[model samples]
Target chain A: MEELMDILQEFEPGVDFEHCTDLIDGKILNSLEILSLVAEIEDVFDITIPTVEIVPDNFNSAQAMWNMICRLQEEE
Target chain B: MTSYCSFPFLFLFLPAVIVVYQLMPEKKRPYVLLAASYLFFWLISGTLLVFLLFTTVSIYSIGKRLDREGEKRDALLKTAPRDEKKAIRQLCQKKQRRWLALGIFLQLGILLTIKYSGFFVENMNQLLKWQQIEPLIKVPQFVMPIGISFYTLQAFSYLTDVYRGVTKAEPKLSRLALYMSFFPGLMEGPICRYRDMAEQLSAGGKITYHQLTYGVQRILYGMIKKVVIADRLNPLVQELFDSGTAYDGGLMFVALFAFTCQEYMEFSGTMDVVIGTAQIFGIKMQENFERPFFSRTISEFWRRWHITLGTWFKDYIFYPVSMAGPMKKLTKNTRKSLGSYYSPLLAGTVALFCVWSLNGLWHGAGWNYIGFGMFHFMLIVLGNFVEPPVAWAAEKIGLNRDSVPWRIFQMLRTAFLVGMGEVIFRASSLHQGVQMLKTMLTSFTLGSVKNGTLFTLGIDRHDFLITGVALFLVLAVSILQERGIKIRDYIAGRKTPVRWMIYYSAVLFVVVFGAYGNGYLPIDPIYAGF
Candidate 1:
């Protein structure tokens, strides 16, 4: 979770990823940012982020992203 | 009927279809809609409807094949030892991918050959001539089936979704067929995905009084926009664009702005009617527009405009291309030095180039459309690349980026970018597009607009006044809608007489001011050609 938070802050410096649930809905993490985040997560966690798993629900908050990362890792 | 807005369609065909749809048993209603949709396609495109049928049959079969492959893989995985399970999965996955590829090729094959082969042949002939050789191939001209471009994308989305396990392979052929042939979305699509439409297409319900009233109201509003504003401005737009060099840059600017207005009104207006028609059947279709002009940047504008296409590209083109094994590997390698901010952009830029290239060709086989695509590509790339620096600069200048004035300025800037791109998109050729652009930059003076020169082209002061007043009404409605006010719901809640009065007034407005039937040529639905 901390690692995910650190990565998200790099894309949007002022965004409070921990508390905010509408990261996607509120336009904090847009498609470009989401792309960047996906690449960064895959690099750090060594799990492929499939296109099917790139939905807003999977990346709307830090915990959500962390959850996705864990699930992808478990599947691998 | 040739158009959804045509009297024959609105007055006769649609009403007849609705009456039949409501009278049919709920279990049989979807078939009625599907049959009507096919008839609508046939009415417009003649025997070209076969192409749509070919797409539907191919996708439906391929989708089921994918489902079987998945089941086979699961069965194998169940029996295999844990050590060999991954290997079996990988092997099965390779086969599924092959099937997916074939399905995509088959779906796009007909579209590519029918829609773009002529352009390819013509370009090839040009290249051969440039090499001092005889042009061997005759430049073949072809007619595209109406909705080929729109329905093909929907088919593509369906195949990919099934492969990705996002949507199950629909076993029922009729459901898949209905998804592809739903007449409202057939012509100028919002390019719906299968997962979005699969259940909605089959959800049968009767048209209630509210549904009927609201649907008719929304359809009327769309008709007004098409006839009263978009069609009204068509002559001036045509006159200026057809021979803009004869006028000052001021008039060229008029051409740009007028075409932009016409395009938005026509496309989005059609969407209103499409969504409204679907609403009558109790199926909630996705919206294609969200007041795009209010966006603060080109990127934001695209997100708001023709939203489904943007999402389709994001899902199928941008993400997949950029995040493919090779691109992801590149992003990883670059991240070691270029870091997070720029690394994905490297891969993203490459993917965006592909998307825009295809997007340009997707609009038409014209070089200007490709140029239009390239123009937006540059803008979006530049916009992404500059975000951090622009933020830093804004902070340095102590600018409140969120202020209304700042936002409005941003919106205007975005609108200008869109207008310039539309100038390219609407131009007859690339050279003319460039020439008009150069004129706009170099000889930009509003003298023509200030003088009485505006009245001469096609529209007079009276026409301009009507369009302006009509536009103001649209603006007022958009503003209200933007503030989270649902105009339809608001009207629905009104007293019966009041609602009737408002509806009657709307119909009267269109009847009186619509640009048709008296020396006015109603411009065809613009995107229908694409």
Candidate 2:
């Protein structure tokens, strides 16, 4: 979770994560950014992400993504 | 008749469909929409309805299959041994790529055959004749089914997302098909993505009283923008731009500016209609525009204007090229050899080239469009190159990027830059674009400005008066939006009297000043050509 926050910070320098609900909703993060984030998450958690679970809802909110990562790890 | 202007569809067909749609059972609504969409296409292109159906079904099935295959591949990756997993992953990736390529090629092939075949055939014939070979190809004449390019691109984007595993393939074929053929987004898009529209498609929510009122108001705003402002500015622009031999320096400059305004109103106004129509259907499409003219930078202008298409390219084209393959290699090598100082600029230039070339091709099979794209690309790239130096000088001189006056100055500068690009874009040809640019740059006679040639472009004093008022109306709406007071939200809060008054005025202004009735040759929606 700390690592994900660090990744988000790297993408958006000086952006406050608390105010980023709209940023995620607006799809301001392009697909490549999403891919990079997914790569980071995969590496950190060491879980294989199933393709079916990669939809917007899974990644649209920081909380949702945290939940997804937790769930993926629990299943593993 | 243009689909928007068709009497039967607007007055008879649409109203009947809306009522029937609301009354239908929730499960039956998709069927109702599907039937209506098919009927709508039939009205326009009769048997070209088959092509539309073919496109929808192929994409829908392909999307579902890709999703399933992707899942299967992932499962295989999980279960396979480590050494085998690597090969399996590669194989799965290859399979996915092939499926995606097939889907894209099928969609793009349909689009090209329908849209560009005649152009290609004619050009090929010309080349062959020049080579002293008998012309083997004949230009086939086909009335391109309305919305083919728009819907096809929408389908392609949806499938691509599914392939990328970013969006799920919509399960129901009917829902997927309806999304593609949804009338509002069909012609020109804030190109609907599956994830955005999927819930809207399945939920057969009955229209509320407020939704109806809001929809009507939205439609009225679109009508006023299109009919009053865009259509009014059309002839003046056409006469000036195509009237090549008529006027000299200053009149030509005004003409160029006129073209800029005309293109904006037409395109954005048409989008207002598209978005409003989607609103009526209880689907919220992405806003393709913000008050683009107010952008303080060229890059910012593109971000705000035709935002969906721009973002689509940035995601699907620019980012991939920038972060992968030859360009990525170049960036890494450059950084290693010469430090990181120039790497971003080099990458930006390459990415911009890809984006602009694709942007130009997306417009049409035309050299002029390519020129238009490259022209803006050069301007934007130049803007980026100069930014650091300009910021440094400003800092040295104590100018601030944050100051209100400086922001206003930058906004005006960006607007002028955009207007210049519009001149090149809206010109008849590359030669005309060059001529217009050269004249605008070199010829600065005060006498030319004082002359009546500016007024002679078919629009009279009355037209100019109406245009001025319309411009104010647009500016006022834009200012409200700029201040973060969304028009819809404000209107939603307004008293009924005030709201109704606004609605009535929109309708009245459109009816009174609109150039569509008699003397106007209906200016086709510009993006329709794409």
Candidate 3:
């Protein structure tokens, strides 16, 4: 979780990614930032997140992204 | 074939469709709608009904196949050992991706072959001639089907959503077909997604009195905007743009601005009628325009105008390209090499390039259209690049960016930029657009307006007065809407006499001030050809 927080902050500093659930819908994390986050998550967790899993629901909150990473890791 | 605002459509076709639709049983209402929609398309496109049918059948088949693959993958995951589950899922996804790709390619291929072949061949021949080689390619003219661009996008969205698991693949082909060819949106569209509209379309219910009245009132409002404001300006805009080089810069500016106004009224007015017509059937379609003129920036202007198209491109093209492997890698490298503030922008610029290029070509297969797209791209990119510097300057100068004067200035600036872009879009060709711009920049004379040249362009004083008054009313209503006041609902809450008076006046305004009858040619919906 700390690692994930670090990644989020590095991707987009000063965003309240831990608490904000409207990250995608509210346009907080724009398309480019989301892509950056996805690449970081893949590198750190060593799991390939499928394109379908790149939805707002999976990346809106830090916890959601963490959960997705863990689920993909387990599947791998 | 009559337009949505024409006498035949307003008095005859719509009434007939509504009566039949309302009288039919709930279960059979969809079929009635399907038939009506096909009739509408047939009337406009003649024998091109086959194209709509082709898209409908192909997308339905592909969606069903993808859904079965999804179901199979889930079932396998349930039964498979933990080690094999990943492999099984990957296999299934690969197969599904192939099917999705096929579906997209088929639709886009058909669109390109019909709509863009001439453009492609012409460009190729130009290049060949420039190289002193034989022009081997012949530009083949096809009677391009109407709404192919719109329906193709919707079809792709449907297939994409199903693949993404955002929406289930519609199992019933008939339901999918109706969703694709709904009459209200068949010509120019808000581009409904399967997930957003499928259930509402399938569940055709009884039309209540409120729905009926509201729908009729909305349609009347649309007619007022179209006939009174848009149609009235058509003659002047046409005359001005057709012989753009002949006019002085001042007159040319008026022509460009008028064309912009005419386009907004015509397109958004059509949307109002389309959405209103759908409302009478108890189906609420999405709103396309939200006072786009009020936007203070080109980017915000896009967010408000033809809103669904922007959203669609963001979802399908912008996001996918940004998040694709190359862009991801580029973002990472930029963040490390150039630091955080500019990294995302670097990646965004790349994706934006794709989006804008496609957006330009999507309008029409012309160099002028491409110029229109690139012009906007340049404005947006320059805005992004200059934001930090502008903010610093504002802070240094103690200028409150939020002040009303500053806001108004921003709005005007954006409007000026947009008007310039529209000149290129409305020009007959790229070379003509360049010549028009040269004329605008090199020459300026107030004498044209002073000497009655403005009035001679086809509109006299009476027409100007009517247009001005109607435009003022539109502006007032837009201001209210910007402030979140629902004019329709507010009027609905008034006393019966007051409400009826409002309704009657709206109808009367169109009938009295509208540019129709002998001298006026009904301008087809601007975006319909696109």
Candidate maximizing TM-score? 1
In candidate 1, chain A reaches a TM of 0.94
Root-mean-square deviation per candidate: 1.7, 3.9, 2.2
How much is B460 displaced in model 1, in angstroms? 0.7
Could you give candidate 3's per-residue lDDT for residues B1-530 as a string of tens digits?
65788887788899999899889999999999999999999988989999999999999999999999999999889989988987998899899999999999999999999989999999999999999898478789999777999999999999999998899998898899999999999889989988889889989799899899999988988998899999999999999999978989888888778988898889988888988999999999989998998888888899889989998888888878777777777877777676555676777788788899999999999999999999999998888778889999999999999999999999998988898889899999978877777777789678788999899898888889999998899899899999999999999999999999999999889888889998887688888888
Regions of candidate 2 where Cα sits further than 4 Å from its true position: A1-13, A17-76, B1-9, B121-137, B336-341, B446-449
lDDT of every model, 2 decimals: 0.88, 0.76, 0.88
- lDDT score, residue B259, model 3? 89
What lDDT does model 2 reach?
A: 0.76
TM-score for chain A, prediction 3? 0.92
DockQ of each: 0.57, 0.14, 0.45
Task: Give the better candidate number (2 or 3) by TM-score.
Answer: 3
Ranking by DockQ: 1, 3, 2
The deviation in Å at residue B355 for candidate 2 is: 1.7
TM per candidate comes to 0.97, 0.88, 0.95
